[model samples]
Target chain A: MKKLSKRIIVGVLTLMLLCSSLFIPTAKASVPYDSYTYNFWLDPVESPNPYVPKDEFTGDPTTMGKFNNPQDLFITKDGIIYVADTDNNRIVFLDTSFQYIGEITTFHNGDTFNKPQGIFVTEGNHIFVADTENQRIVEFDENKQFVREILRPETELITDNTSFRPTKVVIDGAGRIYTLAIGINSGIVELNPDGTFQGFTGASEVNINPISYVWRRYFATDEQKKRMELIIPTEYNNLFLDNEEFIYVTMGNVDVKDYGIDVIRRLNPSGINVIRDFGYGSPIGDYFVRDQQDITRFNDITVTDYQVYTALDGVNGKLFTYDYDGNLLYVFGSNGARQGNFKNAVSVEQYQGTLYVLDNGNNSITSFELTEYGSLVNNAIKLHYEGKYEESAENWQQVLKFNANSDMAYIGLGKVYLRNGEYKKAMDYFKLANNRKYYSKAFTFYRRQFLGDNFGLIMTSVVIIIICILGLRVYLKTKKINVQKREVNGI
Target chain B: MSTYISTLRYSLYVIFHPFDGFWDLKREKRGSLSAALTITGILILTYVIRRQYTAFLFNTNDIKELNLILEIISVLLPFLLWCISNWCLTTLADGEGTFKDIVIATSYSLTPLVIINLPLIPLSYLFNLEEASMYYFFLTLSIIWTVGLMIFSTMITHQYTMKKTLLTIVGILIGMAVMIFIGLLFTSIIQQIIGFFYIIYKEIVFRF
Candidate 1:
């Protein structure tokens, strides 16, 4: 009996150990970026020199050849960086290695820049600078030769009375120049390729207040009505051209309560927004913030491809990166004095795998290199979009081993299973990702399979249910008749 | 205990035979005020719990910012107001039902809804995204059953025809609205009066 009890105890101890093992959480796999505090922190690459190259005129005696409140940076396809040196009134140029190439302080035709805040370079190396203080956009050819200066046109189409102070510029494929000027609520100032004023496009709709509207219509005097502010669109903060020439514009000052207007918009040729809202909640920065001032005043947007874009918010000094479907992938860069943080992040641009953020307060550009996990995610997304689902499935599974909380990995697996016609497995993965549309597609295929297999059983159950319902109804009717008959007999 | 159990059991019978069940509940003294209040309390608990515990896939409630007191008041106040408004209107219309009858009948009519919905809170957890239709169907079924039961009880309690019962139900809804408006106006006036006293008190303190 003692031996028997000893055997039972051994068995119970083994079972307990197995159950405890199941309860223990799995340790997350090591990711290169796992050491960073932010959700998608890119490691700052050690630059040979962080300052923009200066050949002739060094900056203030203490700061040396460093920048002076540079407001924007745009990297061309050939890996050339152009900096809008706003305070110094020059457009500085740099090579891929962060070494200064040259500076454009004056035009060939004797027109010098005055506080140029925005710069854009086309594929053919045509440069466009928004000379903000000069109140005109100066264009330069690939050889740094002055092409022309575009002034605000006088046309019946221009409606806003705001002064023409162009702060940003983006040229579309159709040779349309979309400019963001100070106090311009009409829309992005669209000028024809030859600098003729094109009517406003992508004008934000004015929010109507129902209570104030009724009062104003019924009670306000004519003089009071005249004094009332004209309902106009909010000014566009910045604009960028995507790979397809679609303009992505950001608005800095927007009412938090207005759900209709998004902080970021990708406008089509006709100026209608085409970005998909993935319902991952707000597609902007942090939704639940401690203070209203913490809200992001998005100043610049940089599109790597159609699939990914990053917005640099000046207010909170945060960088919010989103996928094509409007899923916020990463949020980093807090407003702080830390090395990786930005004091006043104004613009972000990408050259190859490096992201350079321009900070106005620091007067410096910071470069961040992609970690291993970032590369893995990018490769998997690229492969999946390229229709190599099976290859991408392996990468997604590897991602899950690192971060089980990744909803995109689950979506990738769902897509793989869907392509392989494994509807049931696809449904499970899509359900995990909370993707209702894909889940419904999988359910339709699963239902067809289920019904095909159990056609006989389903028909039998349906017939049986009908008969049972009818029988129950008839039985209840007879029982009622008998009870009524008994009551009549008693009376 | 037996009387309470029987009163609760009679709710099931009343749901199927609302006309006779409501009449007997009033004329035969079959229902008790305690039992009616218990049913109403259960209804409120069911609503609150359902909003909290429903599966995330089907639950649209912003659980992060949920206010328990506000949720309870939203459900309970409307119900109590409806009962009071219906009773007042019926009294003027020469309806046979008393205040107790109206409250009891209304509470009893909610049995079908509570019965269907209480079980669904747990069952929703078992359903996947595709099987969510089952949960939705039961939700809609409970609402329809309660509405049908309410109309039937109202018709029987007042001894009115179908048309008159519908019209009276509409009038009861309007009366509930008017009561709410008056309550809001009274509260606003009280707030203004308090504000006036507060200003005078501040003036006295500052001047000294």
Candidate 2:
């Protein structure tokens, strides 16, 4: 009986050890890359990743074959995803569950696509395909019927030397079409609803520093000048039309000096850049880069209805999300062959809160779901933007539980405290955020409150000091007169 | 102790009446090296206090990265360099002041920085961002007053014409730059020599 009891105890211990080991692996399953955000000093601060890879769809061969070098991904209001399968010359449709619905390969009397690079789905279920090599944009109805094709616009503004290969396209609320074509440095090509060419908008201004201008104008020989690269505006790589009808565009090959300035732009109706850069750092993807070549080149941008846009860095294979104030919310993903990482991320789209990134190098789509930390951050930003500071403060507090180093959360809480007449607490939060502007505002109120509280004591002290000074002055004058009288009497 | 206090008190007169005060400082033995050094120590303390206790709205420094030793060295090194450069230039330019005289005059001239900026630190806490211009105006005034005092001190100590003193000041600035370059080159060469010997020792050990 004793031997059997000892054997049972040993068996139980072995079972417990095996179970613990099984759970250990699951607990240690961390993502392949480190997630980080920028502090006020532009230093990258590591934090818990707000996104984790949920599902990866490489397409089922039995259903619609596999995606071959897909270049763009677009999600409609109803969460229907359209992948521009560039090399396959088709647009594949999928449901939110990654199940293949159908594809459009041939349309308009058997006219097949020639490397369609971009796809956009309007609210009315109309599909637009940027037939890149064909140099045209083809629109189709909800029933997969071809509506019309917009060819290259015949305008004097577009010189004959410029080729019109549309790479990305976006449609605003009023049905105004904007197309970003290859080798077009002018700007985004604006199109009327009926396919007539409007004018270009949001052309990047070429800034020439004095030294470079002097060298180019007076110093260089004609031969050397001819060999130098021409100074032209950078072309827009991709664009997204937000809910407010503002067009958000991204440029990848900007000059190194202009990396944080014009790389991301939000153009209003009159083509003026109206993006606010009031964050700790500009909405550049990476701050502390190793070299100029390692600078982030934004390949695609996707904006949610809340004005929170995420730009995909093609070079680093990362996603950078920023709020409307250009504050960087989070940065995740990297260039790797791991499940969560991407080899070459080309396009990004958002539906609800999930982000779908299309990888051209791996020919697959990876979906990232919002973690608890991500949802708290989004909730805080959304509430703050909606002027609901009381509710936003709660969400910001929850966000701090996940990321104590989040400056945005601290700033959000600071604003709430400022609104609730808690200036001292607001100042502390802003100090933690390293936000001097809001700290100044909070300090102004705090100083006023401090003075008001001690007003009586301050006035009494001033009066007492003034009276003491007057008394001392009168005593000194009489003593000097007495000394002079004594000296005059020869005492 | 009484003499030290008198010498320190004499800096106020020197700042206000530089021509006679600086002349008396050297010829009348009114200023002492200990007082000058004490004034420098106070200036350093004022700088540290300003960095630490200034209002959050006006302080742009990262408090987490503040190093007390670095702060002291940043102030002391530039001061010593300025004295050395000024003495070297003035001695060659037929001037009258010695190295000790230059150090004493320069330290005395820097009184305005301490007098003006020390009060401004407390006053900074009272001003808001909208009224920051007044604070900055005083800060700039302190710097300008100190610089003007320095030029006057240099002129009186060396007994030179205005143009000659101006030329000497410019030369001193260039001399400071040159000294910094030479110091960097010396350290880099020493580093290379040490690295070379280290590599040789490592190679000898590996061969054996």
lDDT per model vs. reference: 0.78, 0.90
**Pick by DockQ: which candidate is best?**
2
Give a tens-digit lDDT track for model 1, residues A7-71: 99999999999998887644322111212111212222111111111121223444337788888
Residue-level lDDT tens digits of model 1 in B9-43: 88888888878898898888788778888888898
Q: What would the DockQ be for model 2?
A: 0.79
Write model 2 residue lDDT over A85-148, tens digit each, in one string: 9999999999988999999999888999999999988889989999999999999999999999
Instruction: Give the residue spans of candidate 2 off by over 4 A.
Output: A1-28, A468-491, B204-208
Chain A TM-scores of each predicted structure, in the order given, are 0.79, 0.92
TM-score, model 2 to reference: 0.93
Candidate 2 positional error at A314, Å = 1.3
User: C-alpha displacement of B67 in model 1, angstroms?
Assistant: 12
Count of clashes, each model: 0, 0
* CAPRI level of candidate 2: medium
Clashing pairs in 1: none
What lDDT does candidate 2 reach at residue A405? 99
